[model samples]
Target: MNKQETHHHKGIEIFGKKTELYFAVLCGLFLVIGFLIATFTALPFWFSLSCYLISYFFGGYFISIEAFQKIIKGGFDIDFLMIAAAAGAAYIGSWAEGALLLFLFSLGHALEHYAMNRAKKSIKALGELSPKIALLKKDGKLTEIPITNLKINDIIAVKPNTKIAADGVIIKGSSSLNQAPITGESMPVDKTYIEDIDNLPAFNDIDKKHIVYTGTINGDSSLDVLVLKLSKDSTVSRLIKMVSEIETQKSPTQRITKKFEKYYVPIVIVSVFLLCFTYLIIDENFEQSIYRAITVLVAASPCALAISTPSAVLSGIARAAQKGVLIKGGKALESLGEITTIAFDKTGTLTEGKPKLTNVIPLHNFDEKELVQLILEIESLSNHPLAKAIVKDIKSQYKILVTNKASNVNAIQGKGIEATYQQEKVFIGNIKLMESAEILVDEVTISKMKALLEKGHTVMLIGLKNKIIGLISVMDLPRKMAADTLKRLKEIGIKRMIMLTGDHQNVGDAIAKQIGLTEAKGNLLPEDKVNAIKVLLKRDGKIAMVGDGVNDAPAMALSTVSIAMGAAGSDVALEAADVALMSDKIENLPFVIGLSRASKTIIKQNIFISLAVVFLLVPATIFGLTNIGLAVAFHEGSTIVVVLNALRLLRFKTK
Candidate 1:
């Protein structure tokens, strides 16, 4: 059958819906009439024969067509086995049984379609959320056009609450935009017009003045943006492409399973054929031999087992995605269930990784406010993360409006910032910077800094006119949910949780203790992280690694299951990970682990049930204790049972 001809638009195809209803009605009527008549009527086998003819034409015709197609393609699929079994049942004077098989088979096909349609709803939702049109500007006049038709360098206008159609910059207006869908960020961002265009990257920074990407929502204020890229060039496009690549690259187990089936199928076929031939030779009856052959074929078909694992895994993946967790595939799902140890990247994974003022120590009479204000003055001249922390703290502390361009300002790489503030040379940096500037950081101040550092704070020294005036410590602090998540994991049989970081040991240790973890390793480069994971695995524990930054990609690749913290993690990190947490809630960790374990269990149960029925029922039918009708019924029944077993994955939850 041509797929296109049968394909129907989801919401608008009236004919397709009516046809489906018609088929369903016919199936229900035929089954009810046949079963009731066979049980209640005193009519001969002729009555059963009439009911079978009506039912077979209604459902069996489709199966026969599909089976013939498979034969022509040189593929001996379950479809062929099913039709043959149904046809053989009719030949041996078992009319009602063959009709029953057709009815059940049709029901299974409908259920399969329902599952597929449900799964595709996610992609459809994503598609519908994207904006369809954009306002394009040309020759100083703007015209509204479909977003797909807009090209590079075209300027567009975006209203509040409207989705951004393409990746571009802000040229004419400034607003706080919500980029949650694109970046997994929870909050809106304030984007302003670029003042220094020359400082920006020259390559593909289309319209350095204004840019917006597809799927990003504009803020309350309406703004004009330039279209730098179409859908295919946007960030989401790149992510989609990466995901496609990941899907196409099959797991090691999947490749091995395919090879196993390649050899397994032929051997099963040969064995079944020989068994049938031998039975026929001994019995010397053509009909008996053919019945045995049909029984053997039905038993040999691995539909139940074949569909079991993939269905459960696929359902689990869909469930995870709906709950803001993105797991790649079955291989990843399997690995997650077996993880005994989890290695976490420190900075963003554990800590908030954003500056919060922790402690301030004054040498003389200066208070926290004065020291922070002076530090902010020097920090405002630089764009380093530590510098931003000081500036942020000053605003929070005193509402000071520090100058953007500091006078007599000097920033030393890997050191601190020095600037003239209120006619005095104020310095803010690490201990080495103060020492290099000949500013004496007294032993008492050093001890105070060490005390704060030991408590998971980064210490920055502040000086006035070359004299050390105060000690300032800022800490990123652990996420509020981390402790609860860690405790829950321990209770759930995860023995150890380890922290890996590129930061100093002091910071890592403080966080580990606060979060109730005893194991902490710091100062690890990206490569060192991978080596550490290998070492952790050598201890005979299945490992899971969680990270968010670009640097964490290598470690993610090395773990048994890598879960990326999607809320703040880089695209590279997300792509490298097998599982991803859509939100920043670490509490979801236990939930994902539980879901994986449940899915695996269901898959195992399905395989066992399928194999048990095949091994037990097929032989009974072969020995003349059961007929072809019983064999077909068992075969189709086993397939339905396995499918329903796999559907249990959809109910898995992690709260």
Candidate 2:
């Protein structure tokens, strides 16, 4: 459909639902008017009866239609039980009681719909974040076009203070962007074309330099952005789709409740029949017996039980989304709550993925400046994390000295780089790489490397023509919040936390100790990480693996629950992970765990309250303790109670 037609259809649908709610409210007002008239005024009997009948038709007509529809489909539902009870009340000549029951039932239905829609509002708001039209740059002139017409590589101009229309990389201009909508980050992130285009590791909002996503607001400077994704495939669009799918997935408790409902309705109907038969044998009054039977049906309709889990799950999902944690579904949410052990990858998960140039030690009388110059010439061609750190550091310090380029630079997997610079063979890597090159490291250099490794620095040997020349140390620093996050997880009942990495054991242990983790295992390949996760699962039963989502995909897939850290940019990670943290904040991990535990607790509480209400009210209604109107009140009241209780999750805070 065209946009206009699609919007028209949506408007009609929204109008229809609102009209239904309004009609329900109107029916309630008429029922109250009829009650007050009958009780207070000396109205004629036929006139009062006419008012009550009008109220009943207005209030009960839709419910009766729905009940009959279910019956025709060979099914039973709450609507069927409610309509039957209302009909029984009217049959017993209790006009006011019947009218009140239908009014309360219709009102409750409207309110329940309102509450559910409220819970889904955050997801719906995602659709509204992106603008409908974008400013396309054509022939050096800005032209407004629908975002749907924008394609990959199209250059779009974003004016200051305007919402970006699509996900794109900045090719020109510099600005700060507020990405709060996508990442829930509070501060405005600075963006520039020069630095970001060169260092664009991945398209994440947290990385916040080159990429501007749909729905983010640009600050104070015009930017020309090259579109990287179509409008529908943008971050906001995918998030909306994810949340919509999540809403359709039922939690374990909800699934069981659904099964319970199918049988519960039939059993309630049979029990009502038996209750009526017994009352008839005892009282010998058919009307009074039927009245008691209808009350029993109303009191045991299972409305509260039907609503219990979904209300809490929906609320929890919405709350988590607001906090920048995207839980795929209720199943994942439940599994996260039961996590006993969490395995963390070293780089990009616990530590900042970026490494820094820390120490440089020279050997064989090589000048430090010339060594840095040769290292930069060799490392400039490689894209390894350490290479980038070295290149960045050299460019900042010895930019003038970097006059020559390396020839035939080849990176050895898991080792380092080899190249020829200035008619001399050069190799820069770990001691293993030096050993592979048949370069001998003396005792003094080996001791220095050990000390650097012990201090959590990754040391690389600089070898020139089969002789050890110097050593460079780079450290991937822990994230500022990593220590506090680990401590908080411990506070909240996580007993086992381990750091798994491919780095050396000394380096891993040092990083782990800094981050408050006692168990650290290093020198693990990707497959070895998977094996470690398996071992953890065997010992802890329920383990969660958290990583940057690329190299750790296998291990994450093997764990009980998989979390992707800083996944807002990586499509593979987002798809592979059960839960994704949009920003690079490790502190959110504890919040997610805390939220999952709270949601599970709320789900159990809702179920208990619902079942408890049924257990208490059904017996009261079957005996002479409660009447039909009182039974309906308590039944509907319990449903509202459960819904309101679940809604409390919307206000959940990690603190």
Candidate 3:
């Protein structure tokens, strides 16, 4: 569809969803007029009857259609029970009471649906959130063009306080951004122009300090952002698709409630049928017996219980999406709340995923500057993370020309890279690579490397032919927010937080200590990580694995709940994850877990409220303690309370 047509269709769809609320209001208005006329006005009896008839027509229209649809499909639901009860009331000459029952029932539906709309506000608003037009900056001039016309590498000029036009990196200016519309980040994140794009992560869309997302507002600086994604693939578009599927994926509680409704509705209908005739034996007054039977049906119907879990789950999913968390489904969210242990992949989950060169020691008459120059020429051809770090370190310290003289460079998995530079073989790797090549390192340099290794630095050997020339050490530090996030997780009752890494044992332990993880296991390959997860599974009630790369995908798949950093994780990690933190910030992890727990609590409370009302009213209704009108009032009132309670998730916040 064209953009205008798509908007027209959305408008109609939204308007159609509100029809139930409109009809319910009309039903209530007519019901009130009928009651006032019958109780106080000295009007003709038919006048009140007419108002009651109109109320019945307005209230019963939607219910009758739904009830008949179920019956036609050889099934039954709460709608069928409610329609039957209303008909039974009218059959016994209580037209006003029948109209009251349908009125309140429809009103409850309207209000429950309204609660659902409040939950869906995030998705509906997302469709219109991103700007349709962008100020395209091309060849030193700005032209306003439709976003659909934008392409990759296109630069869009964003003025101060304007919504970002596309997902891109700042190339020319610095600014702070209000990412609340996308990331739920309350503070403005600073963005600086990126000068070295090649240093970015190889296999993922890992967000950089200069990365800008669609729909976020730019602060008080004009920025030229180089577009990275098309309009259809923006963050806002992904959220729309994610949140739209919320209702289709049922939670465990919602699924169970549906099963209960299926059998419960049929049983109530049968019991009400038997009770009407059974009462004939005690009291020949058929009027009183039938009245009691209809009341029992209305009271026993699972109105509030039918909607209890779904409403809560929907609200929970919508609110989570608003806060930059995309829970795959209600089942995932419900299970994540119960996780007793969490496994963090050390590289990206706890650490910043970037290693920095900390020490450079030249040995055996090797010049340090020439060593750096040779290292840069050799490392520049490789995409290994360590190689990138080395190149980044060299460029940051000294300017150099890209001679591209290094040739035939190849990475040796688990060790490092080997190449031909200046017509001589240069080997840049760990001790394993040098030892296998029969290269000799002096005792003094070996002791220095050991000292660096003991201090959690990754030691690499620089060898020229059979002699070790020098060694450089690098370290990947834990994220700035990792310690604080772990503290919050502990306060919220996470019993165990372990780190699984592919680094050396000492390196993992040192990083784990900084992040406060309960345990640190290192020297793990992908399969070894899976085995560790298997071990964790046997000991914990439930476990969650947090990862952000292809290596972590296997372990993540084995966990009870898999969480991936959506913006930073490899595609495999995203596919395997049950939940995704789109913001790529570890700080948001606790919020999602806390939200899941709160949702579960709300679902339980709603189920209890719904059941308690039914249990209390059913006996009272049968014994003559309450009439049809009173039973209907309390029954529908609980449904409204249940829905309103679920809506509380929309405003859920951490202390």
TM-score of each model, paired residue for residue: 0.64, 0.60, 0.61
Q: What is the C-alpha local distance difference test score of candidate 2?
A: 0.73
Model 2 Cα shift for residue 554 (angstroms): 6.0
RMSD of model 2 against the true structure: 11.9
Where model 1 places Cα greater than 4 Å from the true spot, the runs are 1-252, 255-263, 275-280, 397-400, 403-406
Per-residue C-alpha lDDT of model 1 across residues 171-232, encoded as one tens digit per residue? 67676565545542222445656554445454254441244557777765667765666767
RMSD (Cα, Å) for all candidates, in order, is: 9.5, 11.9, 12.9
lDDT of candidate 3 at residue 318, scale 0 to 100: 86
**Model 3 local distance difference test score:** 0.77
- Model 3 regions more than 4 Å off: 1-259, 282-284, 354-358, 363-370, 381-385, 397-427, 432-439, 450-458, 464-469, 474-477, 500-510, 521-535, 549-558, 570-576
How many residue pairs clash per model? Answer: 12, 0, 0
lDDT of 3 by residue, 241-311 (tens): 54445322444455564576688789888878877786557854777777888888778866677567667
Instruction: Work out how many backbone clashes candidate 1 has.
Output: 12
Clashing residue pairs in candidate 3 are: none
Give residue 176's error in model 1 in angstroms: 28
Per-residue alpha-carbon lDDT of candidate 2 for residues 4-60, written as tens digits (9 for 90 to 100): 101111112334756446656767777777778878999777777787788787677
Best by lDDT: 3
